[model samples]
Target: MDLDHEPATRAHEARLWRDDGWTAKVIKNGDDDGWAVEMTQEGEDEPALVGPWTMGRDKKNPKPLDSAAFITLVKTASEVLRRHEQQRHALLHKNVTIDSGSDRLRIDLDIIPDEYEPYAELSAHNGFGEELARVRVQPGFKLSRESAADWVANNFARPS
Candidate 1:
């Protein structure tokens, strides 16, 4: 079993710190003699944030990890993860409302990004949130005003 996956106990060291499900590690910068710090959430495979670290009073060593610094790093890394999740959600889900006959319909296209066979679900709902129609379409299906209008015009048939 990998130690990284094990339940963590609190640790506070000069170059490494772990607490509150987050770890901050300081490393030598690849491009220069300066140092860089990486912030990773527990059980995650990759660091959510990596940036330049502050130099110590000697200017040749990295600043020691402290309680305040670790707390700030966890906040920043959590925000980065949150933004990434939001962006991905926006990419996979789409919606538009359009006029259909006498009733307004909300059209949604939710993409399922499968590893080998990606697909999408095209669905429609009425103003009262009743399901009108649902069909599977190609993952690359475009869900725009004109495309939605065309679908509604076709009685919710699967788009070619």
Candidate 2:
């Protein structure tokens, strides 16, 4: 495919391939005397998926990469990246709902995974979704029912 006047490269070598914005390469397994395959997306520095590779007919050589295998590897690598993003999202955003007198409060903790200045935002909202309080807390702050309750009981002050 041609885009921006640049044609996308498409290769199907025996142990390497580059197509559809992904590249698959066969490498020696570090843990054992076997072969492994790594799939990396274009322009990325790291491989999205890496796993064992099948042996060839001679039983001593790694199986040559083919169109079908490359396609499967791309799909698998895509899924791994998708799941990793989902897990990161879950870890960075958390919330808990607790009862405070007759009113229900929802406490949210959003972690900012900055490289140098990591921190988190702790906020509380009422049942009607009105903001009650917000403060900056440590990035590793634990958010749970008890913690949320304690924050509310402490008048929404920043937790230490």
Candidate 3:
């Protein structure tokens, strides 16, 4: 994300921080120079925090949004998110279900990071205690949760 360009055209402002399972970002209004902070928790569908922000030095109004500040904010926010994601991803185990009527399968993925080894375990099994397949995922892989959900809905699931 390039903060050099005005975020006016963007739908959402840059994220600022992610801590305690919550990610915060600063959103700006295109119509006016209004600013708001948005905090979204991991696995949440919506933001947990949304409120007005203080304007720059010109106490009367918010400081005009600019590239330098925007870039700094984005960099800091991204780091927060990255650290939070890494920590959470390391300790939490995710369970994903893919069912096809008569055949119901549950996929369990455990992410672990250690001094010598760091990887995610992907395993699939039927409702009955039967294993189907297992694979290992590298830590560096880019997994877009939103994109994955969209792909499953559009390609695998029936259209509503």
Best by TM-score: 1
How does each model score on TM-score? 0.94, 0.80, 0.32
Error of 1 at 66 (Å): 0.8
Ranking of predictions according to lDDT: 1, 2, 3
- Candidate 1, residue 42: the lDDT equals 83
* Model 2 C-alpha lDDT versus the unseen true structure: 0.93
Query: Model 3: per-residue lDDT, tens digit, 1-160?
Result: 3446432323323335444444556667555677776555556667644556657676544554345554454455557668977878655576666664577666666677766988866556778959766666664434344422442445322212
Which candidate, 1 or 2, would have the higher lDDT against the true structure? 1
Best by lDDT: 1
Decoy 3 TM-score against native: 0.32
Which ranges in model 1 have alpha carbons more than 4 Å from their true place?
A: 1-5
lDDT of 2 by residue, 21-66 (tens): 8999999998998999999887787999999999899988999999
Which order, best to worst by TM-score?
A: 1, 2, 3
Question: By the TM-score metric, which is better: model 1 or model 2?
Answer: 1
lDDT (Cα, 0-100) at 121 in candidate 3:
61
